[model samples]
Target: MLAAMAATEQQNRTWSQIDVPDQSGRVVVITGANTGIGYHTAAVLAYSGAHVVLAVRNLEKGNEALSRIVAAAGHGAREVHVTLQALDLTSLDSVRAAADALRNAYSGIDLLINNAGVMLTPKQVTADGFELQFGTNHLGHFALTGLLLDRLLPVRGSRVVTVSSLGHRMRAGIHFDDLQWERRYDRAAAYGQSKLANLLFTYELQRRLAAADASTIAAAAHPGGSNTELMRNLPAIVRPVATLLGPVLFQSAAMGALPTLRAATDPAVEGGQYYGPDGFMEQRGHPKLVRSSAQSHDEDLQRRLWTVSEELTGVRFGV
Candidate 1:
């Protein structure tokens, strides 16, 4: 009877911020951490006692976020180091420079959270002449990970957590022939492709790390339907309705960051795993181990995407 009671309690347990283990002495680098889900993720990690680097495109905003994180974490018993590193995920040049700077600054890194990304925007291209969403969300993070994987390889319990999205399942697939969408473009489809790429990158990276017999693991997560600044790009006609239904349609950014935090810090998390909310349609709730689209798990497609990403970014992964 006692065992049954304990089992019931365990099954009913709700994982919250309190479940986040001590992160002291660990180093965390989060991109696009100046706002929204990234900011919240950084804040939680900083509070839990990790040295965090906010890699953002806007140094000014990054500084502001750093200050906010420090302020929120407070100077209670221990001090958390929070710094800013300028990184523009849309440009390979910026990604390379940021990676070099980070590599020079830290002898080892515990976590690299590829959380920066763009949403549905009108037809646009990155500085590297690639689709805006695909280049910034997928190629940029891919390059950064390859550049920094060595530093994390030797660090026990190190993780590369890339933030993907449920949108990965929405009209998303690898369009090899039209990688850049030069033939045609749909904002939603393009965003879906980028999110799907994030998962593909994470899985492929995990496979490589495993093949190399490395301890560092790669994981992926999604924010669910959080009402973050990313929603600003919602079609104008739907904006008003979305605003009216915001309370029902979206959860807070702090809540959105939970799945990512869990994936990054949860010791039980394994390589090639994906996490997201536990609510309806995996939309909003506490973090839970989740499954990504079937297409995302295709090994051939993942390998092909890796090759294409390497060709486009000119960055190679030693793993």
Candidate 2:
């Protein structure tokens, strides 16, 4: 709630743009902004007077979200600019096209939030033939961020915010042996690996940026248990229990977006920092600096994943 934050700010306090410094001239690009946490993140940043770009795979849904965000921004009645960019993270061609369009348009970018992702899903692969969850959630974002790093490196205080998940800690590790689940596929584990990749990417990118003495930084955040479309792919057996506990355990998407907003906008945030809900088990509450799993901090795995990502996507970040 205050501009100056302690190691972990007040357990219950949340940061709305009301407490954040003005974002009038900033350019914020957010992926998966059509619904859920991404939509809320765009709305709040629009309310803060930033030029918010809602990057979505579906332009129609993006337009609808644009309308809602405009209304939300109207509550503050700030002259805000909210637009959409076509992006399908499942396709590398799409990632390159989107990155090119952004580069041609903006001279510098302030924030690039890799917020879109898929959760549990049946065995599937991307247009590139990688597992659906891993390809879209991790690889797609990996390529986009790398392609856009040049746009951010020169901007002071610019940040790349990647959203991970609590499920990353549950039976999750980078399965280099079967990276795409070509041999065996478990929906939960596949989702876990993708989420874990998000953190690994964030930390590794931050390291590279620091090594190059670049102005940009990388941070990660998790929404905890938020009521969003991500769970639509949950198995039938677990749906009923999740439904029963949803009201008690899940926070609204707006509340869930706080950790991301904090990580993206907080003045105190540093490279490789993580933010998440402050409630029990990080399920729901206002956000605060949070700890990730030990595996997420493994340097060797981080470097390996980065190398493999570059090889797979063919997009290199010369940090």
Candidate 3:
């Protein structure tokens, strides 16, 4: 029992940027690829010879990121093929349209990285009328995955990798009764709940895929304290302090993206596993397989959330 109860230790084995396998001939779609961790993830994979689709809400910014990624790839840029797709996670219509566009463009997608998110924002609703954090972070990705699952299903070893966060460790769980927080609001708590939802979605997805005997798998990863624009919504009072401490507390966006890259491409990865940094408190270091909160592993909760998500988005997976 004690052995079973022990926290999963960081593997002594190391994984780094160079460890990512050649992605030649692979097709990857990464949301929020215009900047920060998403941009870095797209860049690295492009450098490794994957055709990366930069899914962003803003085409102008997406084009800029494409240029930057191509330039960063240097001579490898000739081998890199990166394109831009407009994806607004705040809107279901946009999610559907983007998925349709991707389907028309690619016969198979090797990886779909649900990496876009909003954090710690003031109370607001998405274009779909759901609370912003929960809507954009969870439901949007849920719908996107469902719409794209068919494309992934036929591809051997294809994966849907959702980028969750260490923030999920906060006092959080699925607020089933108050999912939208229509009665009350706490930005931090809402953010925690959304991140938690990311895990639940991944676990439930993997289960359904397995039960259906599908080749596609679901996994998740966290950036773990990367200094990025995602923090723009931090409370005004806390912003200055975070800014001052950011340099000391955060890793580069490139390093922060390692866990995601591993989760997306690692040959050893299994469905439903979560990956994050191996450093203290699971922050600021190389990627390693990590554990999530017990709530995240609750199969009943996962199924319930999956059902609620399908109801809300009106999108059902083929699995």
Pairs of residues at least 3 apart in sequence or in different chains that clash in candidate 1:
none
Candidate 3 at 42: error in angstroms?
0.1
Write down the TM-score of every candidate. 0.95, 0.96, 0.95
Residues 191-259 of candidate 1 have per-residue lDDT tens digits of 999999999999999999999999999999999999888998998999999889878769999999999
Q: Model 1 misses residue 22 by how many Å?
A: 0.6
What lDDT tens digits, residue by residue, belong to model 3 across residues 30-68?
999999999999999998889999999999999999998
Q: Give the 10-residue window scoring lowest on summed lDDT in candidate 2.
A: 3-12
lDDT of 2 at 195: 96
The lDDT, on a scale of 0 to 1, for candidate 2 is: 0.92
User: Each model's C-alpha lDDT?
Assistant: 0.91, 0.92, 0.92
Cα distance off (Å), candidate 3, residue 102: 0.7
Which of the predicted structures, 1 or 2, would earn the higher lDDT when compared with the native? 2
Candidate 1 lDDT for residue 166 = 89
Clash counts for all predictions: 0, 0, 0
Determine which window of 10 residues in candidate 1 has minimal summed lDDT.
7-16
